[model samples]
Target: MKKIISIYILLSFSFAYPVTLNELIDLAEKNSPVLKEKALDIKIKEVKKKQIHKKKFGEIHLFGSFNRFEDPRILYPITPPIDPRNLVGAKNQFITGISYSVPIFTGFEIEKNTEISILAKRVKEIEYLLTKNQLIYNIKSIYLKILSLQKQKKALISYKQSLIELYKNIQESVKVGKKPEVDLLKVDYQIESVEAEIEKVKNSIYALKSALKTIIGKKDINLSVIEDVRLTELDNFNRTQLLKNINSLDTLKQATLSEEISEKKVKIAQGKYLPKIYFTASAQRNMGNSEYKDLWQVGFIVEYTFFDFGRRKHEYIQSKLELKKAKLQKKTLRLKIIQKIDEALSEIKTAISKIKASEKQLLFAKEVEKIEKAKYEEGVSDLYDYLLAKSQRFLAESSYYQAIYEKESAISYLQYILEEFKNE
Candidate 1:
């Protein structure tokens, strides 16, 4: 038995460390698959930007070919059998060359393309931050819920103990012929009901703990021993100030960037109608039996689609339409975000009011329970009144606890909307 007790002590020590809310959020940020994917997307955009930058560097290619002809054709017709060999081409010939071309001008298309890539990369970064903030909010919400349930469990335990004591007292009174057997039975029934409720709460706690573990990506770790979380109060929140700061939100910034990118695309589409200038250079060698020649050339090339049946014009118009659409979408999103913030603020106010009312109700219920207990002991009240008082007190306490956590959850949601979690 001593050895078994020692082993149990060791196990307890191994699992005793309490995980905090911040630590859980850190774990979630480190392990979140969505954030990792967003990071990869940023890298992809960076690579695409590099590719666009490289477009101005032009391309170099080497070429080589060998050919054999059954009969070489003569470039000029000669009198019959008169120096036909002088006009005939070589039967076997080889040609090898290296060529390079660089774009000197692309009508601003490359510049616009690079800008678009830059905006795309910025968008991905904003998306990553958005995902992280959302994760933090989810973790905080779950943490608050678990804390509330734990508090409720404590209240239930205390109530259950009180019920047990009342049952024992009633049983003793019945034995002494002071209280009837039915009173003892009623108290016994209440005790059983409280026990059942305790069991139900324990099950709920287990399920919530499991959910917490999954969120933190630590399925093997026990979250049942996690430390209690403290709620943060946004005491100095001003709607005007927060609304002004809305532009700092990553979501809004992403939307704005997208609009700018669309405008740049319109410029790119317009550039398609302009001419392109390029510089090209090449060196070549040709060889055949008893003959060899070398040549080099460099030149400028200008290309223009001058007449593409109005294709470029149509594309430019399409891009312009897309830009307008992006602007409208951004404006709509801004309005929605403002509305959401207002809603969250209203919820916070409501929760604060609830907390106050529930606290007062809990105080009154406790006093009533005390008075009912005293009356029952003095034979001035029956089992039904005492049980009803106990139920009301428990309900009041539960409501108070729920209101506190609800306020916390509302604040968390408000912070989430304002991107305050990103600072953490």
Candidate 2:
């Protein structure tokens, strides 16, 4: 009977739990409109690349026409000897033919332009990943915040329980003339104060949870267990290593590809100054006497745009400038990433120190409370000392959670700058 009851309790606990972080991320990825837009951009660039390739593949034209004119010859009265009206009288005609042109070369611009679309697609993919990374960072921040509130709620409940028990004891003593009635009143007021604080913390937890639900596209997120690490983990952080990590992101990779694409653009632009060569073939059949016939011809055609008033020169210069700009942007981004890493590490250190000091103060306060309780029971201690001890403990616990949450925030910030938590 005992084993069955225990199993039932476990099942109930499982069913009542909130959704996890990974599940929320999965749902967001599936439904996020922003990500969908990025994916479509890739498709669009891919199609453009196909068009660029077709520039090399050549063009094929298949055309047909039919006419039955009522006015066979709208002839102006003219002289004999093949009069101009003879040309007009041949009005009823049918035409059908297939003509094709295959490009043999295009100054190598077709191949070079194709790289531009490829790079554009890559840049779009990187932006999408960066957006998703930002979302995950935000989600984790809220996630840890809810956990912090949970810890706070637990601490407040513990403090409130102790206050209530002490209050009950004082009330009994007052009834028996062993304690002052005013003392009972004082403890009762403290109880009310603690309850108010607990209510405030609860409300904050709800707000944070609500925001988190909107992010992960879900309403039921469980923040019961928040994994918090000590701040000492960042004491030996290497700035060089972190900067290297930032460059490892897909965004940085896209930046490099953009430079390469720009180089290709310059090549394509220079190609404009050269001549493009192509081969050609054409066939035509005409029937005016109700007789079928065929005519065929094949030859090579070369087209060279030899000059364009310095347009190609200006274009090549623009492409080179763009490539330089991309490199500068990459350098600026690296500097910013380095700054973020240093600041986050500093924050982690400060939180750790504060937490340690708070821990010591809490221990001292616990000892003071023990002494004050004994004196109060003997009627030698006043209400002030007791209230002060209780307040000290509450404040200490609150600070402890605050430090924890700050450390969590720092860790998350570092993870984002490093792209550690973001999927490639």
Candidate 3:
């Protein structure tokens, strides 16, 4: 454990590229196009929720029309002996009225609407969080790759230095008739091969950084050196507890409210068949082009739709189907969430085992290289054997970093599963 901590400190001092997880998550949220669009949707839904919050409000309607003498208000006579009461005027009719109408009863549109509004909000929120989780995964994955590359690079450089010293000793021995020239050539070839590999890995690291910059929305972000980082060394996290807190993803219960609302919409459609009670109290000033006079009228309307093709039936069936669809979708999401959790847990177990194995391999390689160095100088080992041991150590070191990266990536998967990435 101390060795691990020391490795982190050494890397931090050598290369101070410090970007915390929180900063990465913030950058992603601030710059993501998808999250921004989801935010807009949330705002629009919120506005709708606020506007329709009042279940019952009076309806104020006003209308005016401009007409020529060709079509006058009195052009057509009223109904039943052309009574004035039956005539709806069309000449500059400026009729304004406030009709006070309470739900008196809606097929329950108010209740359904309230539930749907809340569910809509949840859906948008989940979309935003899902965006956040994806961003976190992308950023952290890239970040881990960068660190892994740096660790491998450092190990290669260290191994190269060790081989340089050992080769010089071997050369001195060969000149003194203690070692073979062939062994010297072998060391040179080993050095060249390892150097090529290091270059290839460096290119890979560069590509990973480029991908990360694009995700962060940087036009031209330069990647500097990244220090080795050991993530929080905490006790084993509770997957159960984490998933329990992630129940927000299960907004299906709330989504089902839409079905309830649809049920209410069906009632509302049926209500269209029942008589509606509306109180209409209005004061209007009537005027004509010739000697205009003011006339005031007030009344209440008890209106009912007497006959229509099966329009109400169509509306009820459409609403019922919509409700059924929402319920089915909610159920599907529940199963999806469980599958996601199971996959993450499997990855986590694999990563943990890999990390443990990497730790032992790294330790063994270090000891092997140290022994080979001492032996080569004492003429107990040939130059070729010495260089091979050095290269092997570097390989082991790189593998250690690969294991570290895999561990972090697995943890990221778990975080996504549990929705802790939103906190990031």
Candidate 4:
């Protein structure tokens, strides 16, 4: 009954759903606080764009006013019975009106302002994409590290098992007086070392999982059964094609859009020096008796700021300076992206070479281990030689797996730079 219960528990663990890289990224998209904040920023920019567009339609307002005055006396001595208030205006009065105004021309101010709003919205969109890509990169980094630790743990566990079996063989040899008891003690020490390494790796795995949970905003998720990291082949990468795709990067796009926005700001500042034309119309009714009971009027007005003590001039200069700065920044960003691509390509190449070398070394070490094991079993070799060979094989295996994961991580970084996460 106990054996059956243990088997059931093992099966249950095996059946637990494993978290995939895509799933983690999806969760981050939905739950990450940083992404959420960026989303709100995009919304704010969108609203601002709508406001700028709506301003082109003009405005209408309804207004009313009332006034009361005290009794008045005659102004002239000959008109002693005449009241000055009656000659001048009503003592109590009320007025109401509806007024409308629309801009007939704005020295391209409205057009430039709208362009600024549109560009601002695009900038926010790029910012959101940048944040999203960064989050994906972070998650991929953590996931790859976890896989590396897991691989190391597996290697250590395998090494520990081998040491155990070797220890058993050494103990038998000691009983036959063929090997010294100290050899058994050495094997015991090696086993303990491997076990210690295993423990350390397990702790690292726990810490990494906690970090991943924090990123995805899930505090209690179990991330033990993550998918294995797949290797990216060098033959599949094309540097020329990748460089062409660099324009799709969020960072580059953002810099370009920012430069455009700065240019629009310069135009907006220049608009202040030109004339503004507007069409105005109004209808009003006097509640109290007056010379005109109701009136309506319409007119057009053109106004220009002939001078503002160099205020507008200074603003225009400042805007041009900002535009220059933005252009420089955009140029710098392009160079940085090119550098990043080159670096990632180099890393991928280096990791691939290391992986190949480690694989060859592992194969050679495995052969050496086999020979050492046979020699030790036949009393032709010391425990030290056999243990050394086994350790070399273990290290080679670990190094190979580490290289594989490193290559995967480098590819993930390259994808991030290329904005492949956006497609995902």
The numbered model that scores best in lDDT is 1
Q: Ranking under lDDT, best-scoring first?
A: 1, 4, 2, 3
Model 3 vs. true fold: TM: 0.71
Candidates 1 and 4 compared: the better one by lDDT is 1
Give lDDT per model, in order: 0.86, 0.76, 0.68, 0.85
Per-residue lDDT of model 2, residues 244-334, tens digit only: 6676777668778878887888788777777777777767664443544456668888787667787888988998898889889878866
Candidate number with the higher TM-score (1 or 4): 1
lDDT of 4 at 372: 94
Q: How close is candidate 4 to the true structure, as a TM-score?
A: 0.84
Model 2 misplaced stretches (Cα beyond 4 Å): 1-15, 18-48, 65-89, 124-135, 177-192, 218-235, 243-247, 284-314, 372-382
Where model 4 places Cα greater than 4 Å from the true spot, the runs are: 1-9, 64-96, 175-177, 234-236, 248-250, 283-297, 378-382
Clash count for candidate 2 is: 0
User: Which of the two, 2 or 4, has more lDDT?
Assistant: 4
Q: Estimate the TM-score for candidate 1.
A: 0.88
lDDT of 3 at 29: 76
Poorest lDDT segment (10 consecutive residues) of candidate 1: 72-81
Write the residue-wise lDDT of candidate 4 on 1-424 in tens digits: 9999999989978997888888899989889898899999999988998988887788999998877767532221234576645553456677789999999888888888888888888888888888888888999999999999898999899999988988887788789898899998999999998988899999999998999988888776668599875555554589899889878777887888888889888888988888999999998876544443566789998999887899999999999999999999988888888899899888888888999999999999999999998998887988789999999999999999899988988888898888877655
